[model samples]
Target: MSDLTRKTAAELSELMASKQASSVEVTQAHLDRIAAVDGSVKAFLHVDTEGALAQAAAVDAKRAAGEELGPLAGVPLALKDVLTQEGVPTTAGSKILEGWKPPYDSTVVKRLKAAGIVILGKTNMDEFAMGSSTENSAYGTTHNPWDLTRIPGGSGGGSSAAISAWEAPLAIGTDTGGSIRQPGAFTGTVGVKPTYGGTSRYGLIALASSLDTPGPCARTTLDAALLHEAIAGWDPMDSTSINQDVPPVVAAARNGDVSGLRIGVVKELGGDGYQPGVEARFHEAVELLTKLGAEVVEVSCPHFEYALPAYYLILPSEASSNLAKFDAMRYGLRVGDDGTNSAETVTGLSREAGFGDEVKRRIILGTHALSSGYYDAYYGQAQKVRTLIARDFIKAYEQVDVLVSPATPTTAFAIGDRINDPIAMYKNDLCTIPSNLAGNAAASFPCGLADEDGLPVGFHVMAPVMRDDLLYTVGAALESALAEKWGGVLMSKAPELVVNR
Candidate 1:
């Protein structure tokens, strides 16, 4: 890999600012890295070589003209396929939308471009962001960079894997359940799920409208924070957009201190199902925080145990509604359009042919849940559980500045291990679903690798609504201390990918 490709987005930005390297050089280096290793990693669905270079060159020209620029200007990034990037093929990893180029950019893409960031292209994802593993992607699965045999967590695995594989310094991911943070834990990258509405969702292809949140993925905390700042803020176009000042995340990342802060260790998220190595690292991280002078205590949120069931219901119900737009008549794949066929038959043929197994599964479950007689029993109950989970977060936050847990129950599992067992796959998000259900800010930072598998384990942190800065404060502190003991970041320990010559 080129040294330029390995640098954090922050470092690359500095290099450009100092004129030591041009944005074109940095962008090309990443494109080259993608060409070398992406065959094995399978992290991206598309690679926009010409467009990325053009964007980088524009930034270089602006700098040459002495124009003011954003902190992340000239930095290259990978975008999740779920978000629209005008005229770019945006298949949310489903055949239904394959080859469909959006007419306009998503709010997230608009912000990234406004910051002068280079758009490398769309990364892979689970079909309709439904599955917990990228195996559900109609295109292909994104391999864990640490172990190509292992699955990167989904549905945003492509975004996390891109950064972990050093194909991109930064990436965008949407966390509906544990999509972003679970993958980050499995891949040893930083992934943040900003409070829902804190980041605009104007054009994100919705899986679960209420839960899908666009956030940043990077190799380091500060880099994630920089990307977070660039793409966050209110959007008049999105009714749910939070109309407040973006939390001071950049400042918190730089601060990295936990002294005197009250930290809560979630009582319900750990033990029995969690792997021993994961628990060991999580406890060590908590102990380390205590050593850093933070007051650590156990806090109970009993409702978290029911979060998984509630989320499965709520997500599919929302997904069933959001995915209704792709009914063959729209700008996606259309089938059975023979002159004799009725419109209904065409739509049915198109959906049956285009939707993947996982997408179909969710739609069926959701449709059943929302049926007139079952709606109150299933969907209504799930919403009530969601409310209770949110209340648990509210109650816990009252006793602590932030809450922490093991990002995943275990390290990266072998690809296909749980693909056939849907319930097993759903359990992967056990620790992360609550935050999404409650619409709070949360993140996963590399804590250490699991001793058994030698794959990375993530340290998860959750903060109150709009206190995204606290998530950074905790992540940065853990990253800084862990780096000292490990001699570098956790990704430094990942096995090198053999370049495809």
Candidate 2:
């Protein structure tokens, strides 16, 4: 592997700025890394070799002309397949949209391009972003770089896996539940879910309209923060986009000091279901924060326990409505159109052929939830629970600057372990669901590895809505302190993947 492939996005930018390396060199290095190891890691759904190189060349030319550039200019990034990039195939990991190239750029994509970042290609995801494991992807499961036998947490697993495996230093992920943070925890990378509506959702393949949040993934907190700034801001195209200044996340990440900051350890997120190693690492991270001069206290959000069920109900209901656009009559995967078949039959045939098991399951559950007799009982009740969860966050934030928890209950489970058990699969997001329910900013940073499995455990931090800078503050502090003990970033501890050629 080339040394360029291992450098952080920030480091790569500095190299380009100093004229020590051209953008094409950095972009090609990552492309080569993907070629060498992606066969084993399977992080990318598509590799836009030609497009990425061309973008890199343009950046190099602009730099040679002495034009101003952003901090992340010329850095290569992996985009989740759920986002549309004009003329690039976006599958959302389902056959329904297989080979569909969008005609326009998503707000996120437009921002990335404007920043002069090279688009590496689309990464795999759970079909329609439905499940917690990439096993639901019609393409294939994204294996954890730590252990190929285990899963890279999903529906944005490919994005996380790409960063973990060093195929790309940065990637984009959407968190509807725990998709970004859970996968970050499992892969020992940094993942951030900006405050809901904080990042524009325009052109993001919607899983749940209200819950879906596009965010950044990287091997380091500052790198994640840089990407977060590049993609986050007010967008006139999205009705839900927050009309406010993007938080000073990059500054907070650079600050990395938690001295005098009040940190809360959530009373509801630990014990019982949490693995001993996960809990051990989590508590140690808290102690480290306290030792670094932060005030630590245990806070309660009782409604968090109801977040999982409430999230399931709300997500599917929204997904059912959002996914209705794929009817075989408009675009993407058509079937039973032999000229004699009725429109309804063609739509049914296309849907049955296009959607995978998980997508179909959620659509049915959502349809039922929205049905006349059940809407008031199921969906309405879930909305009430969501409100309670939000209120719990509001109440807790009144006492604490931020809340902390184990990002997930355990390290990455072996692939297929919970695939057959839907309820078990759903429980993976237990600690993460409440944040999505509340529409607040949350992130996961690698604290330490679990002793039993020797896999990474994430230290999760939650800040109030729009206080995304605080999430970076806590993450950077933890990352710096932990790096001193480990002698390097936690990703350096991951087992190296065998190169293909």
Candidate 3:
């Protein structure tokens, strides 16, 4: 790997601006990194070498012409496959949309291009972004870069894995529950789930319309903040898009000050069930914040206990409705249509053939939840609980600047450990579900490695809606404090991946 591959997005941007490194050089380095290690990491489903180089060349051309460019002009990024990119194959890690080339660019893609960021290619994800572990992905699972045997986290694992493996400095991810943040924790990277509607959802394939949020993933808080600003803002195309100005996340990340900041530790999110190492890192992170001039207090979000059940019900209900479009009538994989089968039979068979087991399970659960006779008992009650979760956040925010907890109950587990246990897989998102239910801005940053398993542990932060900057303020502060204590970033401790090539 070239030394260029180790540079953060910010450093790369500065190097390109100073005429020390051309965009093509930066882009090609990442492409080569992907080729060298993807067989083991399996982070990307596609690598657009030609397209990325062409984009990089264009940036170089503008620079040679003395034209002004965006702040992140020459940076290379891995895009999650769920977002549509014109003329690019977007499978969303499912057979249903296999080899499907979208006709239009998603809003996020448009913004990223406008910023002059090179799109290396799309990373793999869970089939329709359903499960908490990448094992559910139809294409294949993304292995954790730190340990090849452990999982990299699901739905957006490919995105985080790419960043962790140093194949790309920045990537995009969508968080329905804890997809982005949980994976970031597992991979020793940074992931942010902006407040619901904080980023446009127009181009993102819907898993749960109300809960799905597209956000940034990177190796550092400032890098994630930079991408957040570039891709976030009002989108007339998405009704749920927030019209307000993008939060000052970059500034907050750079500020790295938690002085006088009030931090609340969620009582329901810790103790019993949580692995000892995970709890240890979470408490240490809290103590570090206290020592850094922040006042820390234990805050109770009583309804948070119901977050998992409510999220399961609500997400599937919306997912069942959203995925109905893939009935093989329009575009994508169609099965059992030998010209003799009826349309209904084709739709049924196509879905049966296209969706993976986890996706099928969610669709069935969601359909049952939304059935006319059972809607009120299941989906409707889940909504009521969702409202209470939001209320808990409102009351907590009134007393504290932000909430904190461990991102996941345990560190990355062996790939096959939870593959057969649906209940065990679902529990991975226990600490992350409340943020999704409340529609708040939340993020996960590596706190330290677990003592028992020697895997990365994550310190999670939650902020009120639209107060996305607070996440960076706390994350950057802790990240800086911890880095100084260790004399380097936590990722320095990650076991090196042997790249064959």
TM-score of every candidate relative to the true structure: 0.99, 0.99, 0.99
Kindly report which residue pairs in candidate 2 clash with one another: none
Query: Per-residue CA lDDT of candidate 2, range 1-501, in tens?
Result: 349988999999999999999999999989999999899888899999999999999999999999999999999999999999999999999999988999999999999999999999999889988888899999989889999999999989999999999999999999999899999999999999999999999999899999999999999999999999999999999999999999999999999999999999999999999999999999999999999999998999998999998888999999999999999977799998999999999999999999998889899999999999999999999999999999999999899999999999999999999999999999999999899989999999999999999999999999999999999999999999999988999999889899988
Q: Mind sharing the TM-score for model 1?
A: 0.99
Clashes, model 3: 0
Candidate 3, superposed: residue stretches over 4 Å from native: none
Question: What would the per-residue lDDT of candidate 1 be over residues 54-157, giving only the tens digit for each residue?
Answer: 99999999999999999999999999999999989999999999899999999999999999999998999999888777999999899999999999999899
Per-residue lDDT for 86-203 in model 3, tens only? 9999999999999899999999999999999999999988888888778888888999999999899988999999999999999999999999999999999999999999999988
Q: Count the backbone clashes (under 3 Å) in each candidate.
A: 0, 0, 0
Deviation of model 2 at 459, angstroms: 0.8
Stretches off by above 4 angstroms in model 1 are: none
